[model samples]
Target chain A: MTTRILTPEELALLSLVQDELVPSYGDLPPAGTLGAALTVDAYLAEQPRLRRPVLTTLRAIEVRAGKAPFAELDAGRRVEVLRKVENADPESFSELVKQTYNAYYTRPDIQASLGIDNPPQPLGFELPAFDESRLSRVRAMGKLWRDD
Target chain B: MAAPELDSDVLIVGSGASGAAAAWSLSRGGLRVTCLEQGRWVDPSEYAHSRPDYELARQTSFAKDPNVRGWAADYPINNSGTPIYPLMVNAVGGSTVHWSGHFPRMRPSDFRVRTLDGVADDWPFTYWDLEPYYDLNDSMVGVSGLAGDPANPPRSPRQTPPLAFDAGCEAYLRGLENLGWHWWPCDNALISEPFGENRSPCNCCGPCDIGCPIGAMSSAHVTYWPKALAQGVQLITHARVEQITVDHAGQATGALYYDDHGVRRSHTAGVVVMAANGVGTPRLLLNSTSARFPNGLANNSGVVGAYLMFHPVAFVSGVFEEVVNGQRGPIGGLMNCQEFYETDLARGFVRGFELQLSRSVGPLSVANGGILGHPVPWGSEHHEALRSRYAHTMTTSVMLEDLPEPENRVTLDPELTDAHGIPAPRVEYRAGENTQRMLEFSIARARELFEAAGAVEILVDPLVQESGWHLMGTCRMGDDPERSVINGWGQAHECSNLFVIDGSTFTTSAAVNPTSTIQAVALRCADWLGRNYRDVAA
Candidate 1:
C-alpha cells in the first residue's frame, strides 16, 4: 500500500534481474515489463520481514558480478552470477524467484491473456452437472470394502 | 492480569469443525454455551479469491501456515526437523476457513485397526456406534455425494448431488475405468444447491481452498456457527486460551484465556471441552500445569502428547497430452480412488493410501512450479513450459495413513513461546518405516493411474509441506483409563467434566480427510453430554 518501498537504484537492479529471470516470450512481455520489481517492492513493504532478505540477496548478487551492480552485467555473465547466488544461498534466492513469479503472473492483464477471467469471484466458471453415467463401470463391481 | 469471571455452563475452546458442531449441539440441547476462539471472525468479502492478487494473497494474508502468515491470533509452532509442516488457521472457522472441503468418512475397518491390521489401538467405539452421528453431521453440513459406491457401507442418500467433475477429473476417472479399479465421485462438504441463506450454490470457482467468498464451501463459520449463534451460543472471538484451570479435586472448572484487549480473564463452566484440534489441544494441555496435576491436567496416562499422526502426503502431478482443464471444478478432489485403501499383507505395509484427484492450478502456481516442485524455467522455454503444464496437469495427493507411534509426538518447546508467553508446541515427527514403504507402493500405483489417463509426463514431490493438514492422535481415546487420555465419550480419563471433541482424541489416523469424522465424533460427544450432563458434572 505504501508508495516506492525500493530505491530507484534498487528498483533498477531488481527489474534487470526480474527480466533475466523470465525474459521475453512472444507477444507476452517479460516479468520486468509486467512491473514485477515494483509489485515485489510494494509487497515487501507489506511483509516487512521479507524486505531485508530480498535486499541482502540483491546486494549479494551485485557483489558476485564483480565491479558491476549486476544490472550492468552482460546477459551471459548475469546468468552465471545468478546460478552461483542460487547455489550459495538457496532460501533467499528461491524466495526472490517465488516472489518475482508471483508478482508477474498474478497481474490482471497476464491472467486475462492466460484465458483466466480475472478475480475469480462474484461470477465464476461453469461446467456440466454431476452425471451418474460416469460411475457405471465402477458401480458394477459392487462393494469392495468388507465392513458395513 | 486477572479479570472478571464470565457465566457459562459449557466452555469449548476453538471453533473449527468439531468445536462448531459441539457448540450447535450443546446449545440446542439447552445448555449455556460459550466458545473461545483465538482468532477474530473473517468476513467473506476479505477472502483472497475475489482479488486480482489472489495467488500472492495465499502466500501472505491467507497462508495456511501460521509461521508464514504471522498474525496476532497465531501461536508460533516449532516444526523443526519435520518433513511435513503442520498447516492450520486460528480464525473462527479455524483451518476450515481455507479448506478444500474434501469430505471423506473413515471406513468401518478404520476404527478396528488394531484388531484387523494388528497395529495401533482400536477405537473404543465401532463405526456402527458413530454411523448415526456421521449421517446427522452430513445432513447438517449439506454434504454433496452419490450413494451406493460399493467401496464402503451403504448409507442414507447424500444431502446434495456430487460436485461436477472437471475435464482433469474426467480424465482420471477414465484412467480408473481403464484399469478396472474402484473409483467414486468424491464426497465434498460443499453445497451443490443453495441450502443456506448466506451461502451461494457452487459455480465451480476452483479456489475453495483460498477461502470461498461465496460460502458454498461448508466452513464451520458459515454452516455450524451461524446456527450455534442463533441458538444463543456465546462465541468470544480473539480470546487466546492460555491454560485450562482445574478445581482442588482436579476436576475441570473452566479456562483462563487472554481476551481481545490482552487482559487475562476467567470463564467458569460446569463442563470444558477441548476442541482445539490435535496439535493445539496437546499444546494447551501440556502448558497447563497445576498442583493437583503435575504432569498436566488429565495427562496421568502419560499419553497426553503421544501417538501423533499425520497423513504424510506424496504429491504427484500428471501432464497429459490431451485437453484437460485443471483449473476448474473443485480443486481438492472430484474423484478419489480407494483401490489400495484396505490393508493387504502382501503390499508390504500394514496400512494404505487414498489417491485424491486434484487438478486446480492457477497462472501464478504454474509459474512458481506449484506443488509439483518444478518451477517453469525462465527465458526461452518459460512460456511453453507454462502453457504445457497450466490446464493440462492433474494432481493426486497420495495420502498415507501414518500409524500412531509413541515416539512421534507434540511436545512443548521450552525456548519458544507465543505472544502471551504460553509455550509453543514443538512437533517431532518422521515418517515411520510403514509409512515410507506405503508411500513407495502408493506412488508407483498412482503413476499407473496417470499413465492410463494418457499423461505424457509425470512429476512427483515425494512429500510436500502443506500436506500436514490432517492432525490427530495427540490425546487418544480408549476404554482403558491407564492407556489413553480420554474415554470413549471423549471425556478426559482423569477429569470427568473435561472433554476432548477434536481430532486429538483419535485412537488411529485413518487414510482419509478427517473433517467429516471429526464433526461426527464431536456430535456424538455433545449428544452424550446433553443427555448426561448432570451425571458427568457430578
Candidate 2:
C-alpha cells in the first residue's frame, strides 16, 4: 500500500499502458486487472536507478496525450501516444513493456489461465515413461570417436 | 594484532566438491582432516523452489552471479577484461550446490591432447590411471547412468538406473539416430532410486541448480560432507583464508584466515591442501608471498595463476509441436552427443565439442526473454508464443573445448579488495581461434539435430560468453616443476607438503563438465597422500 515509489499520476499512466500491453481476452485478465502496475512500482522501489527513467517515460506519455492524463485518453489516442514515445526512446519503452509483461505473466492467476502450475515444484508434473526402443538406433551407432 | 592459532594434521582450504571428496578420503584413511569454508551452510527451509515467488527468490538469494546474490562471504571479481563474468557460489558445497549435476568423465584422448592434436599440454597421467578413482567417486556420490555408454570406455556398473527420458530427449535421441550421431543418456550425479541412508530419489522438482531440498541431487553437502563429518572431519564455516603461511624451507606451514567474527586466525597443519577452486586457489597462492618465495607460495615457475580454461558455449533452441514439458526433469541436459569430441584434422579446430540436449525452460523464462536467440514477442503475439513455446521448447548447449592459454588467467586486482581486506581476483580471458571454430562447427551440428527432429522453429545463439561454469587450469598439473604448479599426485612441485586438489590443477579442459573429474582427481590425491603420509608429515 506504500505509494513512495510511484505517485498517483505515474501509477495512473502505468495502469493505462499496462492495459494496452496485455488487455483482457477470453478468461485472461489484463495486466491492470492483475495489479501489475503496483508490482512495477514495488520492483522499481528496490532499483533506484531505474525509477526515474520509468516515471519520466510515463510523464512524457501523459504530456503527449494533449495536456490530459494518460488514463483519460481514448484507447486509439493512448496507442498513438505510446507509439510516438516508443519511437523517441525505444530502449526505455521496451524496458517498460518487459517489466509490465513479466509482472503480469508471473502472477498465479495468469499462470492458471495459461494452464501452468505457478512454481512447478513440491508436486512436480510427471513425464511419460521412457520408451527404450526409441534410443535403440542411437545406441547402435556405437563408439563414433577415437577413444585411444 | 597477534592472531589465534589452531593446529590440525591435514588442513583443506575449501569445502567444495574436491575439498569434500578429499576430506572423506583422508579422514577415512585415519588423518585428522579439517576443512575451512568461507560461506555458511544453506538453510533447507530457505530453499524457495516450492513457493510461488520462486523467480523472486532466485533473484534475491540463489542467483549464480556473486554481485547479484550479494552474500556476505562472497568476494568481488574484476570482470572488466574477461570475456565471461565468473559464476561461482560460496557455501559449504560451493558451486556444487548450484550445479546442474552433469557428470561426464574426460576421455582417454583428453589426457594426451598434446601428443594427439599437438595443441595443448597433456595431463601428467592417463585416463586409465584415474578410471578406478572415477568409479569410486561415482559409487560414493551415486551416479545415475547406464553401464554401456558407447561414447565412453567400458566402466563399472552404475549405482542407480538412468533418469527417465522425457519427450524432448526422446525426440533428440531419434534425431541423433537419424543423423547417425553418437548419443547417450548423460551420466548425472543424481540419484534415480533411493541409495544412501540420507539420500532420496529425484522427484524431478526442476530446480536442481538451486540446491535440492530433498537430498536427491548429489551435491557435496548432501553426499560427501555427511560421510566426511561422520569420519570426524572438522569443517570450519565462514573462514576466509587469505594466504598460506610458508616456512623458511618453502614448506607450507599453515594458513592465515579471517573467521566469521572478523578475527584474524591461523591454522597450522603438517599438510595444507588448496581446494579453493581455480580462481580462489590462484588468488591465495599469489597473495602468499614469503622471503624465500617472494613471488608467491609454490609459484617458483610463475605459472600458478596462468593457463586458465573455461568451455566456450553456444546455445540452440528448437520449438516442437508436442508439449514436451520443458520444466519437468533435471535442470541439465538429458542426453549427451559427443560425435565430435575427438580431434579431426579435417575440421578447422584441433579439438571438438559436446552437445547436451536440455529441456529445462519454464514459462517465466520464456516470458522474460526466450533463450537461444528466440526473443519473446510483445503485444498479442506474446501470449500466443508463450502458450506454444512454454512447454514445447528444447535447447542444446554446445560445450566447446578451450585449450590452455597463459594470458587467460586469474590475477590479484591492484585496487579492489574483499570484505576481509584481501586483494580481489581479477580474471582476464578471451576465446582463442580454436574455440571459436569449434563453436561455429558445433552450432551448425546442433541446428541440424533440431532440423532432423522436425522442429517447427530453430533458433541459434552464436556464442554465450556468460556460460563460464567449468573453472579450470589456473594451477595446472604436470611432471616438471618449471611447467606446472602441482605434480600428477596433486602435490606442489616447489613445496613438498603443499597440495592442490581442485579444478585448478586441470592441465587441459575437455569438451564436457568438469565436476566428475574434479572429484575423481581429489580422491586420487587423497589416496596418494595416505600412502605417503610418513614422508609428507616429516
Candidate 3:
C-alpha cells in the first residue's frame, strides 16, 4: 500500500499526541508503525460494541492536541496526560493526550509489522535471554510491584 | 449492558476436563448442548510443537489478550511475584490445554480424608460411588500406568503402558527406598503405545506443562471436545458469564455474558451447568445478585464461595554430575512417594503431602537460575553458573494437601470490576496449619532425598506465595444442603437442573492432582443427566 501523506492538521495533532504519549518519540509518527495506530479491527475485537467509548477516548486526545503544542510541553506535563488517559478513560486533559499517544503507538499488529517482538510479559515484565547479571538485578529488585 | 436473548437445551460454562466431559456426555445423550468458553480454541500444533516454544509459552508468554480477563488482575493469587499462578486457560479446552496429565483416581481413603483422619469433612460419596465414572474417563482418555501397586486403590487394567522414566527417576527410586517410602509410577493420561483412539504414543517432550504439541497428552481438546463438536455441541468462545438468572421459584433459567464482541448477550437454557472453575464459578454466583437471592446465585446455604483450598507446592533442586535431560518427557515422571499422603501418628501436620518425583531442570530453567552456590553477578559468573547447573540439576516438587478452611474464601470486591464493568472475584485465603506443617515435613524430606542422591549442593525454593490452583470447595458436595453447595450427585442443592462438576465440588484437597477426579465426576454427572433427562431435545 502507498503511504499517504497526512494532512497538516492531522500531522500536527498526531505529533502533539505522540509527544504527550511518548516524550522521546522523534521525527517519526507517534505510532510504533507508520500507519494508523488504533485500528478499528483491534478495537472491535475487545470492545465489540463500544465504538462510542473508543471515539470518545480518541476525541479527547484530539481535543488536547487541538489546543496545546503537545510536542513543546515539558516531559512532566507529557507524562501527566499519558498516565491519566492510559486506559480507555481519560482522567484529565493531559491523560487524554497521553492515552491517545499510547493508543497510537502501542498497536499489536503495528508492532508485529515493525518486526518488534517486544511485548510485555505477564506480571508487567519480560524475561529476556538468560543473562546472569540481568537476572540477578531483576531478582534483587524484589517485590518492585507489590501484590497488595 | 442489556441481556441478549438466548435459547438452548443445555448451557455448559467452561471448557476444562469436567466441562468438556459433561458437554461430551450431554451431547452424546442427544441434548442440544451449548458450551460457552471464555478462551478461544488454541490449535496445539500451531503454538506448542517444539520444546523450546512450549517452554516459552509456559514460562514467558502472556495469555492471548482476549483470554486475559478481569479475574486475573482482581484476585492476586500468586503473591510470590512469580508470573505463574492458578492460570485458567481461556480457550475452548481450558487448563486441559496445559496439564501434566497425571490422572490418578481419588483413593477410597481420599474420599473420606476428613472422616478417617478427623481433619476436614468427608465427601458425601465414596470411591465405589465414583469408580465406574473413573473407569469411563480413564477408558475414554486412554490412561497409562502400572496398576499393580498396592498403595493406590484397585482399578481396571490400564489401557496403555506406562511412560518411560529418566536417570533422575532411578535416583529418586533409590533415594525413596532408602527412606522406606513407597513409590509407584504415576498414572498419567498419556498413551504409551498406539491406542484405540486418535492419540499417538508419547515422544516424551516434557513440555506438557504448557501443552503437548503432538497427540501424546490426552487433553479435552483431543479427548472429549472433538467428540462433543461432532455430536453437534454448539461451542461459543470468548463468552464471559456474568450472572445466572433464576425464576421466583429458584430454578435457574439462563445466564448473562459478554460475547466476543463485548456485546451483552444472554442464553436461556432448560439446564445450566456452572463449570467456570472454582474461582470463576463462585465469582459468577456471588455476582449474580437478584432480589430473591441477593447474596448470590444458589447460595442459600451461604457457602457459594467458602472453603477454598490449593495444594501448597515447595520445590527442592540439587546439582548432580550426570545430565538428567529433563526436557525430554512429561512434566512429571516416574513414581510419587505417597507414604506421606495419609496422616502419620508421628507427623506434625494433620493432613499429608505427596512427593512427586518429577523431571529436573531443562536448559532454559537452569539458565534462569544460576548454578548452586554460585550466586555471582550476571556477567562471567552467571554464564558459568548456568553451564554448571544446566545438566547437573534435578528437582522434586512437594504437593502439600491443604485443609478447606472456611475463612479461605472467594468473594466479590465491591470496588473492583472487570473490563466489562462486572464485579471481580476477590479471593481471601491463608495457608492452614496442616498445609504449613506438611510443607515443613516435605522440606526436610526433600533435603534428605537430595543428600541420598549424592547431591553436591541442594537449593530449596523459599515458601512464599501460596496459590489457589487446585481450586476446590467453593461449591462443595455433601449430604446436607446446609453444609454444602452441591449434592452428592454433583447437582446444585437448590436448583436440581443446575450442576457444578469442576474442582469447585471437591470436599477435600487430596494429595493427588484433582483434574482426573474432576473429569470422572463430570462424566458421571453427565451420565446421570442423560439417564434422567433423555426426553429433553434440542
Candidate 4:
C-alpha cells in the first residue's frame, strides 16, 4: 500500500504555486493543469530528506499569504506572498522551484508542446550531412604541434 | 571453510576499457583467459533512452555518481577529504557504458611532462612506443573522426567519416576562427556509419552517456568483449574480487573473490592482471596484506596508492539567439580547441587545458541546476527563460591537466566497507596551485570564446567538485622500483607475474580524456605479455 505524504490542503497550496510559476501561455497549459503538483508530491514522498523542508517552506508561504487561504488568493497576492517567502529563504524556494520545473518539463504534454515527438529513442533524429569544407583552415594550418 | 577454486592461464579483473582490450589481445594468443567483472552485462533492451521518462535516468540509473545511482554492486567512498567526488561505473563495460565516447589521444608532450615542463614525473615509455597500439585500438573501436588534425601529430586515418556538425558546432568554429585559435572535430569512438560486423552507425540519440542501445557507441561490451568472447575468453559477471593472493616467493598466484550469491570463491592463474581502474586497483593492493608484505601486497616501496591525479574541470555556457537544437546529437563536445594545451611559463601554470564546445543538456537536466551561472527563476519569467534558452545555449568544458601530488592518494577507509565486507576506498585529494591557476585561465578563455561567438548572456561555473572522472597515477609506472608500483610493461615491480593494465598505471593525468590511451596501453601490455608468456608461465 502507498502512503500519501502531502495533505489535501498542502497539495492545493502546491498546485496554486505550480500554476503561478508555469501559468497558461496562450495554448500552453499551466503546470497544475498538467498535474505537476501531484508528480512533485510523488517525488517528495520517496525522498524523505527533502519532504520536511518542502512541507515547511509551503507552510511558511501559506502563513505569508494571510487573510485568505493560499489556494483562494488572487494571482497578484499569491505572487507577493511567494516573493516574501523567496526573499526570506531563497535556498529552500530555489529547491522547490527546481523540483517543480523538473516535474513540469518531463510531462508528455509539455514535451509535445515543445515539439519533441516521442522519447529520443528507438528512432533517433537525423543529423545534417558532414561538410569537409569546415576543415579547410585547420588543414591549411598543417601540424601545429611541436615534435620535440 | 574452503572456497571453491577455478584455474586459468590468465586472470583479468574488471571488463572495462582496459581489461576488455587486454582480454581480447591475450585471448587471441591461445591462452585460456578468464575475466571477473563485479557488475553484470547491461541488457540493450533495458537502456533508459528508450523509455518515456528518459530524462529522469540522469538521476537514477545513468547518474555520473554511483552513490546517487545506488546500484547494488556499487561501493561507497568517503569523499570528505577531497573537494571532488570520484565517479565510476561498476558494469561489465564499466564507465564506458556511460561515457560520451570522446576519444582524444594524449599529445607527445604529455609523456615527458617532467622533461618538458618540469612539473610532473616523466613516463618511462614515449608516445611513439604506443602509436601502433593506439592505431590498433582505434581500428578495433571504429573511431569516427577526420584525419589531419593540426593540433595533434600526424596519425593514421580514422575508420569512418566524422560526425556531422550542428549549428552549435558551427558557431564554436566561427568563434575559434575569430580568435585564430586551433580547433578540430573531436575524435569520437561512436561509429558515424556502419563499418564493422560488430556494431552499427549512431542514430544521434543524444543520450550516449546512458548506454547506447543500437551498439553504435564503442563501449567494451560491443567492441572488445565480443571479440574476446568469440576467442573463447571466459567472462564471469557479478564477481567482486577481494584480494590478489601471492606465493611465499612474492609472486601472484591467484585471486579471492565473492560470487554473485556472496559465496567465497578463488581463481588460480599463471598471470594475474589487475585492470580494476585507479581506485579499485589501489584498494585491492592495500587490502591484500600478508606475512611477506605487511603494508600491502606490492608495497615494497610504500607507494602502492600514492600520487593520485584527476583533470580539474571548468564550465562556461553562452546563450545565443538562434535555436541550436542541442538535443539532436552526441552529448560530448562537437569541437575541441587545443591551442593552449602546451605549457606556457607566462600563464603561471606549468601545463594547460583543452577547451571543448558542448551543446545544451536536455530540458530536465537544465531545469535541475545543470545551468552554470544563474538559477532558473519562477513565475512567467521561468517559462520565458526556458523558451529562449531550451535549445539555444552552448557550453564549453575546460579540461585542465592535473599534476600528481603524493598527498592526494587513495587509502582504505578504516570504518566504511562495501556489501561484501571489504574496506571501501577512501579518497584524499586537494587541487594544487597549478591546477587552480589553469582552471581560472581556462574559464577566462571560455568566456572570451563565448563573447567572440556574440552571445547575449555568458555563464561561468569554475571548478565543480563532481567532475572527477579521469582517474590516474595511483599505481604509476616508472623504472624506479622504490618509487613506482609498475614498470613500463605494466608488470608490478615487486611481483613479476602480477600486471596492472588500466588508468591506474598512468604516470601523469593528460589534458585529454584517458579512455583511448588506457586501451592503447592495455594493448601494449598484452603484446608484451603474449610475447613472453612461455617464460612467465615457467
Q: Predictions ranked by DockQ, top down? A: 1, 4, 2, 3
Leading candidate by DockQ = 1
Q: Which residues of candidate 4, in runs, are more than 4 Å off?
A: A1-4, A45-53, A59-68, A72-77, A80-94, B1-6, B371-374
The candidate that wins on TM-score is 1
Q: How accurate is candidate 2 locally (lDDT)?
A: 0.84
Go through the candidates in order and give the C-alpha RMSD of each one to the true structure. Answer: 2.4, 2.8, 12.3, 2.7
Pitting candidate 2 against candidate 4, the one with the higher DockQ is 4
Q: Give lDDT per model, in order.
A: 0.86, 0.84, 0.66, 0.85
* Location of the lowest summed lDDT over 10 successive residues in candidate 4 chain B: B1-10
**Model 3: per-residue Cα lDDT over B1-538, one tens digit each:** 0123437778898888888999999888677788888777776455533422233343324332113333232222222322224556656777777667877766777788766777788888888889999998888888888665556656799988777766666666557656666667778988877875666677664556656666768888888988889999989987878888888877778788888788998888888888888878888888887776778888878999898877777778777777665544666755676666666758876757777777753443344442122222222233345446654666777887778888878887777677678876667777776677778888898889878878777887745242335778899998888889988767888777678889999998787788889998898788887777633211
Query: What clash count does candidate 3 reach?
Result: 12
lDDT of 3 at B266: 84
Cα DockQ of the candidate 2 complex: 0.54
**Model 2, B1-538: lDDT tens per residue?**
0112437788999999999999999998788888999998998887877776565555558877786777998999898878777788899998988778999999999999988888778899999999999999998999987777777888898888788787878778668878888887888998888998777788777877677888888889988999999999999999999999987788888899999999999998888999999999999999999997888888879999999998888889888899877777887838898888888879887988899878756666676655554547655566787777888888899898899999999999999999988999999999898888887888899999999998898887787755777889999999978889999999998998999999999999999999999999999999999888768852
lDDT of 4 at B229: 97
Backbone clashes for every candidate come to: 1, 0, 12, 0
- What is candidate 4's lDDT per residue for B1-538, written digit by digit as tens? 0122438888999999999999999988888899999998887777878666787777667787877877888888888898888889898888898888899999999999988877778899999999999999999999999878888988899998888787888778768889988888889998998967757798888877777888889988889988899999999999999999988888788899999999999889888999988899999999998987888888878888899988888889888898887777888838889989998889988888899777766777666645354556678777677767778888888998889889999999999999999999999999998898888888999999988988888877787777788889999999999879999999989888889999999999889999999999999999999888767751
Predicted complex 3: CAPRI docking category: incorrect
Sort candidate 1 into its docking category.
Answer: medium
Backbone clashes in candidate 4 total 0
* Candidate order (TM-score): 1, 4, 2, 3
